[model samples]
Target: MTRIFSLTCLYILFLLSSCSIINWEVEPDNLKITYQDEELSEIFHDHILRFIDEAEKRDMTFRSGKVNIKWGPELANHVNATTFSNGIIKVNPSSVKINHDHLSLQLISHELYHLLCQPPSAYDHRSRHLISGTPYVSSLMVASSKKGEFPTIDNVEMWEYYFDELFLHHGDYSFVYDYESNSK
Candidate 1:
């Protein structure tokens, strides 16, 4: 029966991976993990805790109580990591399986940066959102980079987009770019 249950779970995970939208599950302690995987479940939990530790060590304020971390095959193809401004981080399990401290730290810092900047709403109704927040949390990391608060990503287009929003939110200033001119 155990073998059959495990097989059934694997099959469900297989189906989820092929879906257009990833499914999220609520675990104990109000923690949210993306997708389902019996094999990688423990490892995912450990990494979330470890990422929070690393974030705190770096002086980053990461509120794990309100964030969803996804490290299962539900991630889009060829994607290593991605985050929603509202506090969902999608990562590839293979990216964290190894003990590469640098990669792990960078990714953790990046996601934690999102949680700190935008501030996620806790799942237990511990907090409330006055307004709908922004999307594309990665771009906000780029905004922080402009102020030397976070690391800059290599994606120029995304970086430019976030900078525009941040400045507009700050003061009466705007910057425009000719994408066609820079495309080449």
Candidate 2:
């Protein structure tokens, strides 16, 4: 059974990878590290902890018990970071360009916030009309930062409107949160 399950997982991963809209390549080891100065790392760590604590207060659980952050210079400027269901968040090592010491800690929190408050499924919920009924908890992160504000609550509310229109004819909300969507 274990062998069968492993093979099944591999097959599913292959399918998902092929269907992914974001095409990201793995970074080489030598270029994979972003060495932040002591001060910046400390500051970034504080923010990250705060984000996690806030989520916990709301009874939210991360897809992965631990969030993994990595930095590599090969990433493009447009690419801030991407969060996978498996709990990996990769940031551009050279994101600050000149000031590597000032890592985008809020940006890191923003991405993790997305993971913590993901719509439960990959199916775009942007069309749901639930409005106040469907809230994106991460929106609160916005109030804390000017640069890496989490997705606006208004944006999420609009997403609810669109989701309902597309998925359900009525305003009834029906669906299961899919945490296994990216399970390996």
Candidate 3:
């Protein structure tokens, strides 16, 4: 029993220490938006703002800083509508203009969540964009627990993203709360 307890304590200590390395802390209010093509700027900005409002309603504070939004010819030909903590969200304008049944919003919203709260590792992030987002989603719970993330922002965001991602998958738009209900 003593040996097992000692081993458990050591493992816990190691887990706690490792968590600090993978976390990329960025304030939610520091997010910024800049447009490569001035024309599509407003459109993308509106979408981003909509996401922010939705997140806030859920008590998530993803920042509102100056994020560089690249689209149109300025957008990379082979980019996957990426979002980074560096305040940049790049998307193909063609995809936005012809969203093909509102798929673009789904894609952008997913990336927005990624930017708002990053995955634990670069590899995990890459894997998330693949055809199978489920595997990665399941991994979030285990990975976060392994890292021993306590009551931190990263931990909270991880939970929020986990549930939100699931909600996104089922085409549910009931996340927004009724403000008037609070008055009652």
Candidate 4:
């Protein structure tokens, strides 16, 4: 009886997972507009501008930064944003599905970091040398522990950490933040 019950439970879980509505496909140079919502686009644009402003103030090289954003359902099993090589960032628009402005600036900011540091050409071998301080494993751990809430602490740390690292790569990193405390 116990074995039978366990199998039944497993089947139920599978059914639930299959029924989930979120799905998306990321393609090169193409905007996958999920849910086809116009209002969400405007709201995301405003936040993107704010992110650009902050990025510019920190580093002038990114002053002319522009990114293509495509909205879609929170398709990834993990509720997060991603930047593709084609200079586009994909955002899970579920939070804004109800309240258009409920989006988080941190999401856009984090992905923008990826977009900026991307290699200018496919032939640039140095692109692989750059590191994303927020490792996928750590991000997965924090995501599972919080059950989909934003990692405020990690987000803030990443902002400073990535900036310092980026500056250091260019040499003369006097402007970079001291990472002594990060050791803790």
Give per-residue CA lDDT, model 4, range 1-184, as digits (tens).
9999999999999988985632222222222223235764665655555554544555534311346777646567465555676656666756442242322544554455456543434212112221224322122111122222333434656544544443334322332223433443
Please list the Cα RMSD from the true structure of every candidate, rounded to 1 decimal place. 15.9, 13.8, 14.1, 16.1
Q: Residue by residue across 29-118, what tens digits does model 1's lDDT show?
A: 444455445543443455456444433444443344456656546775455566676666666765542244333434544554455434
lDDT ranking from best candidate downward: 3, 4, 1, 2
- Best prediction by lDDT: 3
lDDT of each: 0.43, 0.43, 0.47, 0.44
Q: Give the range of the ten consecutive residues with the poorest summed lDDT in model 4.
A: 123-132
The pairs that clash in candidate 1 are none
Whichever of 2 and 4 has more lDDT, that candidate is 4
Give the poorly placed runs of model 2, Cα more than 4 Å off: 1-40, 97-105, 119-184
Which sections of candidate 4 miss by over 4 Å?
Answer: 1-37, 63-66, 95-103, 120-184
Q: Identify the superior model by TM-score, candidate 1 or candidate 2.
A: 2
What is the C-alpha local distance difference test score of candidate 2?
Answer: 0.43
lDDT for position 124 in model 2: 25
Winner of 3 and 4 under lDDT: 3
Question: Against the correct fold, how does model 4 do in TM-score?
Answer: 0.41
Error of 4 at 71 (Å): 2.0
lDDT of 2 by residue, 85-179 (tens): 76566666555522421224346545655554454364122232212323332222232223322233244443333233222321223321221
lDDT (10s digit) by residue, model 3, range 1-184: 9999999999999999997664344444445656786665545556556566555555555433455766534656544465666766777665533233223334555566666554424313322221122222231212122112212223444445444543342222232122113313
Model 2 TM-score, 2 decimals: 0.41
User: What TM-score, over all chains together, does every model reach?
Assistant: 0.33, 0.41, 0.45, 0.41
